[model samples]
Target: MKIAVVGCTHAGTAAVKNMAELYPEAKITVYERNDNVSFLSCGIALYVGGVVKDANGLFYSSPSELQEMGVNMKMKHEVTNIDTEGKKIAVRNLETNEEFEDTFDKLVMTTGSWPIIPNLEGIDLNNVVLCKNYQHANHIIEKAKQAKKIAVIGAGYIGAELVEAFEVYGKEVTFIDSADRILNKYLDPEFTNLMETEFENRGVKLALNQAVTKFVGREGSVEKVVTTEGEYEADLVILC
Candidate 1:
């Protein structure tokens, strides 16, 4: 049987690797838009804080490794559409823009979570970004070069770690959250309290329960972060 896999993150990478080893006779094809695969986005903060100096430490697997295991690895390839009726997928080479159709007896989709896009005034301005991939992490560092005050939105895993990293990098940071506390979805109030205290002790601004009304900017760049409470100056804005 022939199998086609879309995406090559945690889920897709595992599926393709297991299938190729378990069923060597069965043909397998893996499509990934990124040049690299199986990146541990969770470790980005460590990378940023200099805890992990090697950028390769963030990647879990490579396309060449999969190819060596008898899997047909197609990097920089993006699937445009799926023809479920015909058991084929329409795909394009992102680098070449060449389109092609591939047939398969089975299909597996492991598309991961997407970064949320918040609609706010001046959000489209420069230096506003999301920390989701390698490119994003690199962009964050690049933008920090000219920024004095950085504002990070959301209080999830990425947000918390990003703020911590910024503080370590000597960048004045203020974390904004709409909820009453940080990590409300995961940790209880008591544990969250410990974390809050740590951030506060480190001189990181924990702006909680403050709903952002808009992003005020000038010259197409972020100038201030406006919320229900007041406006805070920000040279760079990030969402995670």
Candidate 2:
């Protein structure tokens, strides 16, 4: 049997590992757009905060390890088109820009999501970043080092964690969210209120219930965030 898996994140990694072990005689191939695989994105905040000394530890699996299990690991390869009727897929090697075709008896798609980028003025300015994946984590860490004021544009788990991490790093952090409270989807008011209080005590600014309208920048670098409620100074902005 021949199997082709698209993407190599958590789900794709698990599928390939289990299949390679269970069906030892079967031929399996995994295609990932990224060079690395199985990155623990949840640890991004810890990594940015300097808690995780080694960024390599964030990845649970690699292409080398997957290849050792008798599975073909094609990193930096994107599946451009899939023909279900013919059981064929068109692939492009990102590194060499080489195009090829492959046949598969079975296909698995674990393609993940991308961050929602809002349409706002000055958004394309330098120092504005996103929190997701391994590359994003590294970028955030590097930017955070030079940033004096950091603004996070979300109140969810990752956003809150990043806010706390920036606070610990002594960077003036402003937490902005459309909702009235942080972690409203996951925690109750009482819990969120307590967290709010703690953040306030630690000098973390909370700009809740406000929608971001524009990003004001200076000389191609982000300077301030303009929201529905108020404007806050931010040298770096993280869109969670």
| Residue-by-residue lDDT tens digits, candidate 2, 1-240 | 999999999999999999999999999999999999999988999998889999898988889999999999999999999999999999999999999999999999999888999989999999999998889998998898889999999999999999999999899999999999999999999899999999999999999999999999989999999999999999999999
Instruction: Determine which window of 10 residues in candidate 2 has minimal summed lDDT.
Output: 137-146
In model 1, which regions exceed 4 Å deviation? none
- Provide the overall lDDT of each model, using Cα atoms, as 2-decimal numbers: 0.90, 0.95
Name the runs in model 2 displaced over 4 angstroms: none
lDDT of 2: 0.95
**Candidate 1 per-residue lDDT over residues 119-211, each given as its tens digit:** 888879888888898888878877887889999999999899989998988889999999989999999999999999999999999889998
Q: Least lDDT summed over 10 consecutive residues: which range in candidate 1?
A: 137-146
